[model samples]
Target: MITAPGGRTLDLANLRCVFTLQGWTTSQWGSAVFKIYNLSDDTANAIQAGEFSSIQLIAGYQNNSGILFDGKIRYSSRSLENKTDQVVTIQAVDSHDAKVYATINQTLGKGYDAARVDAALMQTFEPYGVTRGRTAKMPGTKYPRSKAMFGRSTVYQDLLAKQCRFLWQFINGQYVSIFEDASLDDVIVLNGRTGLLGVPTQTIGGGAVIRCLINPTIQWRSLVQVELQSATTGYFIVNSINCQGDTMGDDWYMDLNCTAHNNLVDKPHKDSSKN
Candidate 1:
């Protein structure tokens, strides 16, 4: 018997059920079925219709929420055909959807195909290394000086690579040092920052900058000579920038001012705070 969240009693306790044992039949497929009674009690509505399919249940006490079962159920269907002979089919049950479908599918006309489900079991997830990684967004210095004689741009390839690296951190719980080269393992480029000027200079200066491949994400210093005095030109060390990792939360990219520190350059006496 499963009680709905809105205090509706969808009674299935009286329904006769059957458990299908697989592997005894074949190694590649496993299946089970349950028959629910369609009856209405004087106090509560009987199982007007019950259907479930391909639900995978696991046994564990999940984090004080209650016993936890997490997995995808492949198929499920439920409907009120008639008060007399209601038919239902449920497959591929996961702990997450039990409530929604368990409650309103009869009214919602929803069903999932169990056989068509895709499944992958992994021992671990390392996005940049063996696992796949992804990233998106336009890249470039957000500040306009990024264009005029007062502005500069990070290379598109470098920025995109860094952005991809940043994404890996988001998914894989790791960080690539912006100070390091992207050619190193676990690094990717973001094609983020663009529409800005990144012309190579005959000379290098102290304020040369690099942007994270993921925009508003991170930046690195590329001063040909950090010791250069008052010179404002150089090939921004495109490889030096990496994602500014988030510590307290999941927004390593949102805190741009801290990532690229672009706005800081736009301030007066840009050399005043050269830490």
Candidate 2:
């Protein structure tokens, strides 16, 4: 069992981090080496699977004490010689050392909404058959990239557009604020939905708030002549919406059911807009 460190308020429940064999891939007698590096720091410490690693983060408070990691076996090959490493990482805490009380899980505050977002991302990308590759953009990059696309389907663009949409809906009412009439880049207040307005109250040059439609419930197929941002084109489904904004940064996150569409359709007038 992992223990919380001193001066820390939270700890990673190692037991809770369950792992499963996702799948197996064989590359016709090719070698594959995989490693996990800390994206939060400059040091590219390789972490071993099923162990803890230290990851210093910015923006949120973190424990100076080390961290824990749980990873799967990495497979590597160089033509018939295949090898796998036990998951590994830079040690953050000692099991026998004094437990520090630091906020170990930076995203714990995001709660279930964060989980929902992760699920959406995984569902969208995993099916595309993308694989991780060594980074030329930055030396010693550990994460995977889309090394190949079966049909050149532009999956990355679609994923980004969908993510932006999700962010837009999530920031509504929960992060409330109005943008200026002229400025394209203004920090708007985000308040999770309160059901007052189903759309963005502000926009530039009388255009569609494409980001505003990212919520799970906003049916994208119903739009008609609504000018959209270049990076966005899709539909959304609202599986469930929970609104409970009573405190600062407190949100009422909704469970969503989303879909994407490539064609325009006739816009149905709402009951309130009746003359």
Candidate 3:
């Protein structure tokens, strides 16, 4: 679905769309690419003219459908295919990407703790349209006087995550941080009945790579229960997901890279103020 100018929603049957949504558990920004075909001239012009603001990709069966990608359009272009069909391709990044390179130059006073610093940062990001989502408990580290924060916001976020021994990323439009070994409560069960495509394969690092029919319930940092072969049956933490789908093609599926839950080892904690 696309939100064009004037708040109009576009989802025509003649419009064919293929998208790739990539997610990661690190501080890197998640991104999406959408190729829409057979759009009307007006719609194509609107998109190419930078009149479209946001796009959403939803998948799964009727009652189980959910958002697969939601982001602001960063670029759009129109091209002719076979000299007959007009296609528009859009590239987008999650909300956090908009502010990843934003500069932050603030000074904290003495006795400011981790919680207070986090709150101040969130307040700064609010004006940029990023809201705080679930975040792990920050370490109990207090800053001394003249704690200067400078440079890109993402760099600070990465430093903070490393200091706390956690991972942080943006999903949809919200910022989230979580411990490496912790998992979301909602566990998606994957099996023959639930659209598991083939036997999962193990990576050299003991992680698993799997493919399945598009399921929106599967997301980054979430847990999935593999119920196929005995050797591969266990809970896994999703590290990354690549969702590929085409309305007019047989390419609707999700490829996930996951680590076995039991194989995850928490990193040793470090002093937050050392950096």
Candidate 4:
């Protein structure tokens, strides 16, 4: 079910839910790409570039559990391939909406703790509905200048390199929170039963691009165990997760990229206080 602006609800069963999925991770604004059969109604053609002020995408598992992707409707497109064939596709994003575009020019004269820096980042997004969770802190410089920035993605990535910590959004719907902690958590094991779809082709430097079932718990930058082989029997930090699934069908999956923690990743800067 999707709740659009003005409290108008569009029931999936009523609209013929085809297939769609949402993706959220660090440095990137969360997105929900929706494709639904539009023959039953004209909502598709009616929706404008920003028709829906706010929208929420809700899904459920077989057990009757629910997953929510609450964000602003950033874009919409209507298509009619044939006289009788029509479909509506909508793309929604978190508070990090590009529509409200602006460059960040904040200077922390004496930078705060790692957690404080995370809070500052969230502050830029707070007006748009972002929160903090499982924050990590490290001793670091007091001054970091981010001038004439374009978006949040680059700064967050730069912080990851500089602070020796990771920052990202782990979705659980409106309950979604950001991770700024160095010691990550919420480890979910991936295997034959836990939705490990197929063989995870491991790569050099202990990185692997793997696929698995659509599990909401599979957060970005979190830890996971992949029993791909006896030699690869260990934990891997989820570098990224692309969640693609159908709200109406059982065709759901997650394409994940992970890296070993001790993969010799270089830190962008040494703690100013330490030096």
Give the C-alpha miss distance for residue 212 in model 2, angstroms.
8.8
Estimated TM-score for each candidate = 0.20, 0.18, 0.87, 0.70
Candidate 2 segments exceeding 4 Å error:
1-151, 155-194, 197-199, 208-215, 222-249, 253-275
Error of 1 at 260 (Å): 69
- Single out the weakest 10-residue window by summed lDDT for candidate 2: 21-30
lDDT of the structure predicted as candidate 4: 0.56
Global fold similarity of model 1 (TM-score):
0.20
lDDT of 4 at 108: 48
lDDT of 2 by residue, 76-127 (tens): 1112122532222222211111111111111212223422333333333233
1-275 per-residue lDDT for model 4 (tens digits) = 55555677756655655544445445455667777665445565456545455565555456634454666666777787569768777776765442244235465444445545544555665454545444444445555544332455335535543555444453532222333433244456778877798887677877777788767666566577776544355566666666666645677777778765554233222111110
TM-score of 3: 0.87
Residue range 1-275, candidate 1, lDDT tens digits:
34333445333434532222121100012233333334334222222232211232212112211111112334444556667754444442322222122121111112322111100100112221222222222233233222111111112223333543321121111111222221122211222232122322232333333322123222221222111233442222232222222222332221111122232232211111101
Best-to-worst lDDT order: 3, 4, 1, 2
Higher-lDDT candidate of 1 and 4: 4
Model 3 C-alpha lDDT versus the unseen true structure: 0.77
What C-alpha lDDT values do all the predictions have? 0.25, 0.22, 0.77, 0.56
Q: What lDDT is obtained when candidate 1 is compared to the true structure?
A: 0.25
Clashes of 4: 3
